[model samples]
Target: MSISARRHTRMATVAIAGAAAVALALTGCAGPAEKPADGEPVEITFQSWVPNIDRAVDAFNAAHDDIHVTLETITAGPDGGYATMLSAVQAGNPADVVQLGYDAIPDFLINDALEDITPYVSDAKDLFVPWQWQTGVFGDKVYAIPQASGPLGQFYRADIFEELGIDYPKTWDEFYEAAKVIRASDPDRYIAAFAFNQAPWMIGLAQQGGANWFVPENDSWKVSIDGPETAQVAEFWQKLIDEDLVKIEADFSSEWNADIQNGDVVTWISGSWADAILRGTAPETSGKWAVGAMPQWKAGENVSATWAGGSANAVLKGSKHPEQAAEFAVWLNSHTDSVSILTEIGAGWPSIVDTAAIASLQDAPEVFEFYGGQDIWDVFAESDKAVDTSWSWPPLSSTLFASLTDNVKAAVDAGTPLVDAYAKTQADMVAALTERGISVD
Candidate 1:
């Protein structure tokens, strides 16, 4: 939570412990392991934001009498409870297992606040999507259990395209063409809006072979948030704004919601979880929406990239019930029944490769009802496959999001060009990382 400048030793230093020591830490340190007495159970506290976590925890408690998990819901914070979780950890009274975003793992790990759970789920490596699995890992140790994945997908109005005689656009060029045609039809209506406040959209675009700001060095990190490919993305959007082809509006505001409901905003580029959002916000437009793939660089390419909103379950190292915590985390994330329940209830997209969970979503009448009876789960599932798994997030992802959002808003308001915003974001990112004793090559 504190970003004060401090002088330290090597910035990129990560101490790798032996597997035996890691196992001991996961089992409550080198002391004698505590076992529940004849009737007593090893209790572990789980802090989470998911509303349906009780369903899973109750099932777990009923099935296993030895390890009981008590669920606690924490109020959501602006930074997604990052600062609150750190404060708890610093106070030496952290929850045994906590809900965590994959992007924030590096920050917690850098502070040595998470427990290495590799010893418990070592053989469960092939249970999740390969890319989602990578989010839980730091160095050679696994610090978290992946619960959900967010792959980008585009949701558009089916009726609008039908009315305008425009088929779905496959390539960026056709998308641009569609934008021009649709926006010119009405003064108040536009194809879509490029919201400057949300940096996840920009991150998703950058992952589409446009640019990658962070690269892995030997033990350090290379910070380069600006490049020719990223500039290509910015320049394309800039042209759209310059020609008035797209609306530059604030995201998630009352105005934006009104635009969507009023048919002023037709197409939405976001992750799989957005299906729930569209259904919840504009029930008036029910059956008018349909899901599809995002526009790619090439006409035939099917590639897409991820945006915001994915979290993992991790155990804290200082907990007394580390083994029970690890077991509970693994079961909560990897169990087939739990996965099915979570996905069926619209708890984001499940990262686990549970066939039953996937089957529950595919062609299910309920999953397609909001999208005019179209099988949207299939579209999102395909997008998941097309995500670029090689992309990496910086350790200071929270700071990166804040800085990028501000820079992008400046670009939108002043028309000084998004490339300049990218430059400032890069410099700020470099300075912020270096100030935290992090190596930025």
Candidate 2:
């Protein structure tokens, strides 16, 4: 494919088809690279943050005599990588391939930063989980290859629950009752932490309750940060906060780490990727912790959601070799050699549809032994299948996250109802999108 075929003359079709007039063009508009001389490998660059990912890249280079990919390590997105990638895009120089979170795909599309690689990678769609594949598709165009997923699950201190004679709650109502029991047992401990500062965590909770914060309608976005389902989720947590049944703490912080290590916090409702985080942060609590499916909205129901941990690999807009880059990306995430490496290194759950084929995942005794010898992958597999395929992300997700975090933190410090934060964010989001010339209803 030529560079122009990959480049977008304007913003992506999905987010700005008829909303307003917006223009974005690659400055150089150079022609595609000439065919490589015989026996000369095609050289391309890949930007990513996954730990130990170079093992997979090295394997790719060794297996393919026609292509060689150079890996460039960068800070994780939201910690300067996204800014760096955008700066490179605007400067007419960017890596051939870049890693992006699922929620951030729409943002990249809106900025015209991703290449349309459907011509080269469309056939590989069947290799990944259905919903995960959809994350890279918009308006019949495939912009990326699904790399990994983060289906929701619950991580809890099993020893503490057993000591208190409490079983894992199966439903939200039962979870609330269990919270009361845990709170009554000791004032220093709570069933969980509010973590109001983490917008992605709250978004997953709302999604589990069947909330769609953003919807595409008539080529415009229907913003609904204050939808009823989201309000219900907010109100439920607000009750827990009002009654002092949950602690107010920022997750992954020193205070939160202490709580986890000391058993002051009993459970965490988060993505499957949190397994690595929990083990790395609180190694002392290895056998005491276990994983389970998220508490359902109703008894006997099975539904789940994903967090921001899931990511995809996209060919950047101005790549000189889009076809080779796309081919390398597809193989990096799907080939047995690469998938095994990713599994062993704990790169989020592999996005492959048939995860059972990965030898590392099939017999992870060490992972099982860490969580009291229970097979935690079974829980994650079930959670991954239960995720709602109808859910989607929206453009300007950074703004959405920022607005929600600011409002929720203000509500927490002011002793006001938490649902009020969502209400305020709804108005803030609509106005912000409108000011950017993007239609919002």
Candidate 3:
């Protein structure tokens, strides 16, 4: 294998740089890493979106003398970081390790941007929670180590539910009714936002019932974005929107934040990671919020789904220190102390199950303070177990999401019909994939 040409000095930690500048800094292909002269360390550059994760790097630096990691933060995740990383890789300046979303793994693979870490991490497979760990495996080649996992749930205002003489809806039918009840109390209030812009959210809901929107055949890929289960999920949400029972808002916008703060959006269909976001956004709503099991297809059904999110550390193909990067990625995610620090910083649920990391999260009063000190981890932990394991992200996930977001969002904005948009999404997805020379079913 040809080594990357870029190399960094010992203990090199650069502040987040512009894409071109960072690419220039990381550009090079050196043969297998050579120990620095005068007993200097080998430096590994990491690009990620998680804040305060530097504590883990510091911990690793303190424990290991030969290897040092430097973390780089991106301005916008899932969109900006993925693009910049691709630019860096194409420019031959890729970081030694990059934090990538589980959904984005196939894109990186499609570009051949990740190094196969199977030789290093295949043995440690048993250490991580099974499904979370499997996110990095494609074509039986391990590309990365799981750093976090987020199981889906319905986060809602408990105080409001109590004031209105209602309980958390256990089924979508009940949720629709609860939405009416909530809306009836104050005509301006809404139960939740059915964001057509949120493709992952739609995909997650469909995944709850074993949606098979994506499939693969031989070396090519196939997509069925309008699969039956997905259509059912979409039709349900569409009814809520059509009835004006749910709000429609672009996420992370100021208006959305205002709705959340003012309780205009009383319920949020989100994942475990949103817990931290909720607390950070609505500190005044402290003790008023709670997480419940996801709304199911039928009442009294014990079921849930995983929104395709979370990130992992991958040894980039351009790295000259694949072995060192692989080892560091594994240790950063698996070492008990390191994982605890990550969990402490609210890095979502631990990828490694039943570890002190999860135990600490479950036991932390502050972690659950937003939920009136309830053990919401138990909700997410169980949800994680019940997730639809039949689903796997398609290699063209970005295209599929873009197709759904654009076409479906148009329908939502135009007041046409959401279910009808699914057909367009499927057609657009198939067309997009076909342009990429990927087979579409």
Candidate 4:
């Protein structure tokens, strides 16, 4: 019935001056939202980027006579929605509920943008995965409801690996050897692309290698983007770049799309959700692709990580109906109807405790057929279990991504070692956090 000591310590650091300002704003600007009149449903707005999620909202509205939710579709957070939401928060009006990536929870918490929904949703805590549920909790307060997850995995061109006599890599060392073989076999083909432009993918790799880039420490953050475990990941990828064993390319670009279609880029080390992207990008290459668990750091290790795709629904600070909003968030994610719709739409893997009970997940024939008849969901389920629960995202994530991307791009352009970018990022993060009046340990 009590919060863990680790979480107690972590959340203590989130109550900064920004949080104080938000608390004052909430108390001074608005009182508790009043209940609706007799026979009138409480109306609330929900903002999200997940395609076809509106259908789930419709289902909720039809099923619940007490609450009616309006779905306001927006661009994915990284593209623009985060700024839009923050602006609304600053202006003293925001949607009743909004979708946010797991990593963004800390930033929202530090800014006090989210409402404490603990009193409303704590009873349903056992319905979802524990680690994911924790993503929404700061100290002892729950600010969000877990909806989806992004367990890391490998999506590869199975035909190419077979043709080159290379088995699916099970370890990082074996992956390097496979990279060498793929390059030596065909000048144009490589094992995977070095996606320096994508910060989340790079961070996921470091996480898989036991890197905790950010740690909560005594009411401050211990910044360690250049730690030893991260160094191992950087050096491994840098070796691939130096040897020309992998293509240096930005993902989802015209060039990268062409490579994926033509089999030049043989593998994509991304989240389980990538299967849908690959299917949409290259429908002509069906049955050529397959899925595998992320290659381990050592021969038998089982560490995994979450990509940026996992998201949660949080009630904003200024909502007039936080109680109804929290109820809708919980029902929409846990109910079979909503979870099935989410699965059909290729929303990231659901965070429900009983994934097996979801029929859509158990028998997705079309999805299996696309990936060479392999049940890719099985791989993701295992990867989800292997993920380290200790990994935590820091505040100022937007700054973190921009700094890492710019520094890494500069390094690549200057022909400097890619590992140097992490060190540079270390300095950039500390400066930015200090300027914002956040303590760095």
TM-score of each: 0.88, 0.92, 0.90, 0.94
lDDT of 1 at 47: 86
Better of 3 and 4 by TM-score: 4
The digit string of per-residue lDDT tens for model 4 on 1-441 reads: 333337534654543553553443332123479688899999999999887888899999999999999999898755588878877877777888999998887777776678889999989899998878888877677889999889899999999899888989999999999999999987898899888789999889999999888777677778899999999999998899888999999999999999999999999988877777888899999999999999988888898998963889999888889999999999989998899888777678898898777887889888899889999888998999998777777777888888998898888879898779999999999997777667788
Clashing pairs in 2: none
> What is the Cα-based lDDT of residue 84 in candidate 3?
88
* Model 1 TM-score on a 0 to 1 scale: 0.88
After superposition, the stretches of candidate 2 with alpha carbons farther than 4 Å from their true spots are 1-14, 18-20, 24-31, 34-40
TM-score head-to-head 1 vs 4, winner: 4
Error of 2 at 219 (Å): 1.9
Q: Rate the local accuracy (lDDT) of all candidates.
A: 0.76, 0.83, 0.75, 0.84
TM-score of 2: 0.92
Candidate 1 structure quality by residue, lDDT tens digits, 51-161: 667898898899898898999887543375667677767666778899887777766766667878888877877887666777777655678888887788888988998
Q: Each prediction's Cα RMSD? A: 5.9, 4.1, 7.6, 2.3
- 186: Cα error in model 2, Å: 3.5
Candidate 4 is scored at a TM of 0.94
Q: Could you tell me the lDDT of residue 410 within candidate 3?
A: 91
Clashing pairs in 4: none
